[model samples]
Target: MTTIELDTTKLRADRLFQRKRLVGFAIPAVILAYLTYIFFAFDLPGLAGRANMDNAVTLVSDSWSHKVHVTRDNRSGEISYAVEGERKGRYPEGARPAWVTGDEVITIDLGGDHIVRYLPENRTEIEIPNFPLIEVRAEGRSLVTNLPDDLPGWISASNRRIGITTPEGRITLTGARTEVFNYFPGWELFWFTLDSPYHGQSLSKILFGERVDPARPNISGAMSDWWNNAMWRHKDVAWAIGETILMAFLGTMGAAIIALPLGFLAAKRFSPIMLLRAATRRLFDFVRGVDALIWTVVLARAFGPGPLTGALAILITDTGTFGKIFSEALENVDQKQIEGVSSTGAKPLQRYRFGVIPQLVPVLLAQILYFLESNTRSATIIGAITGGGIGLMLTQAIQTQKDWEEVAYYIVLIIAMVMFMDWLSGWLRGKLIGRKD
Candidate 1:
């Protein structure tokens, strides 16, 4: 009896050990097999070859830095100095940057050994630190360069155009235009354009010192110029941010308003009819089944792109979610409270108002405020699609491929907006429902 019993127990223990061993090996094996499949399925090996690290590095650098453009219109032979090659950032009349000097042969010092000179009669000279002195001439629609047959990797030359790239700056020569880009660390003309008298004034000066613009007060003038800055577009950006917040607010509040009644119909305690409850629950599932992004796409196609359309998309998608959540909360309410309200000879409406709603307020406010915060972030992506809000501006900046700094700015703003909404939601929740602490 002892021998047989000992063998059965040992056998059971062996089987359990074997099962555990199989699981341990199988988990790692499965993971390794999946990884191997992913390596080829996603073409991870080819990703390095496809990626342009140079462009990526340049884009990263551009996000924090600004570039000044010194351009020569070859046809008119009129040289112009501007920031980022924009008309709004063009230098004032009879004025130019201190780095650029010369009346006849315009010499541009690109802050390193890199130097460029605009000579008379469509001729240009470039001086790089290590490279040989190069000269080129533009004749009508073609560029004739003194560049050797075997040029450096940094230099790109053709019959019509030539481009020289260096760490300090870049130079491009074409039949129609000759331009030099000089990189600088900070965002230039961020507060005020070249046209503004307060462009170079310090904040302290604007706030405490003498007036910069004689026609207007220092504070007012500085504010006006900064708000109206064409390069930064602070006014437009503020409006876009407002649209995004409004979209989220309208959508979230609207969804809550629509979901409340439906929630009541779905709740077992409130609506006793099985058929009505099932239908309402199904409606909730149907609306929430599709993602907000999918809803956004559908609404955009039907109603056309607008902030209101984005709000509607959010409203539709969240209605289902809110309905499910509210229904669940309603079902979990205290029966004693409802009975107490009923004992006072309260009507059905009065019972709900006094008993059910009081119990649900905490849950309702908590869910509503959370969704409101979440919807704010969602609104950004929705705004991009609906052609409204900061998302549209961010997309425009990214698509341009020229102003990475502006893209960075918009990204920072988006993050800040999300953080602010999070803080506001938490603060409101604490104030309304009492803090957990």
Candidate 2:
């Protein structure tokens, strides 16, 4: 080749290499610039400053522990002991906790060196190790305290109220009441309320020993009390769980049943008309693209909130997804089996049943079962919006901001439900379609 031609070829190769190198460096530089913008745009640097660690820490601690409230009414001079301050968990008449002592002046020992005494005439005494004795008096619409102006971080005081926090417990003095909350490690009164005769009985005593309640048999009474326990509401929770599962089942199955026929209409092989195929495909996109939660809100507004509303929302959203998937599967199906079925003089519906459907069963079952498990979790969130299932109970518990233990309980139940659904779906797949692994 000529020298001029050789020089031109070398120049072209060098320019091509430079262009490729520039493109590679430019792509990452663009990504880096975008991420840099996002970091400040999202205010990530100020996230820690915006967080309330005290409330977060308290919430985490409350989820695993229970507290008993020792409340004294300043107006009536009446003292009451209740678990988590719930009236249903209040101590019976003439009954009190072991930690409480004294007849007229009630003394509460909060396990460490923390002690609280409900003095006469709406006065309270608090003693903590390494600190001076703090006294407070709750009068009408105001508080009188020995707390200094230069107070510690653990103490919050105002003219009308005073709050003290220590490792052992928390104390609050107000114009209307004086309350001391002593925290314990486990959920109290979970099995039976204070009204139930089985509240203090041991497992062995209730099961094998004498009758705990004279009104009913030992086992039967114990079972009944636990089921109807006002604090836990086991029956209500069970029904909510059932409702969530029903929503998932009805929605998933309903979607699959409706999508199967619509799939045939969207497939190029089955649908000869371009307009019909395009319309069906667009319908699938329109429904699926809007999202399940959006559909949930719309349906809830129209139909009103219920389990059926949640189910219909799920059905509408999943039908679009299943239609798109089924249509694609239909388009890729083997035509030889269809031809053989036709040669046997099988009519359209019969050919579809024997030929098209048989080929699609494994795919159909696999997708259906997988979606059923996914929809189970989706139903939980949908139930929250529709006011129907365990999700509603969970939302209520979380909103209360005091019942973190119940929130924890509902969360654990939801995780367990999802795990069970996962196992059940896998088992069904194994039995009906044969497991791949």
Task: Go through the candidates in order and give each one's C-alpha lDDT.
Answer: 0.93, 0.92
lDDT value, candidate 2, whole model: 0.92
lDDT of 2 by residue, 1-437 (tens): 99999999999999999999999999999999999999899998999899899879978999889999999999999999999999988999989999999988899999888999999999899999988899999879899988889999999999998888888899998999999999999878889999999998899999999987887999999998899999989999989998898899999999999999999999999999999999999999999999898999999999998899999999999999999999999988999999999999999999999989889989999999999999999999999988999889998998888889888889999999989999999999999998753
> What TM-score, over all chains together, does every model reach?
0.95, 0.92
Clash totals for all candidate models: 0, 0
Q: After superposition, how far is residue 420 of candidate 2 from its true place, in Å?
A: 1.2
Error of 2 at 328 (Å): 1.1
Worst 10 residues of 1 by lDDT: 428-437
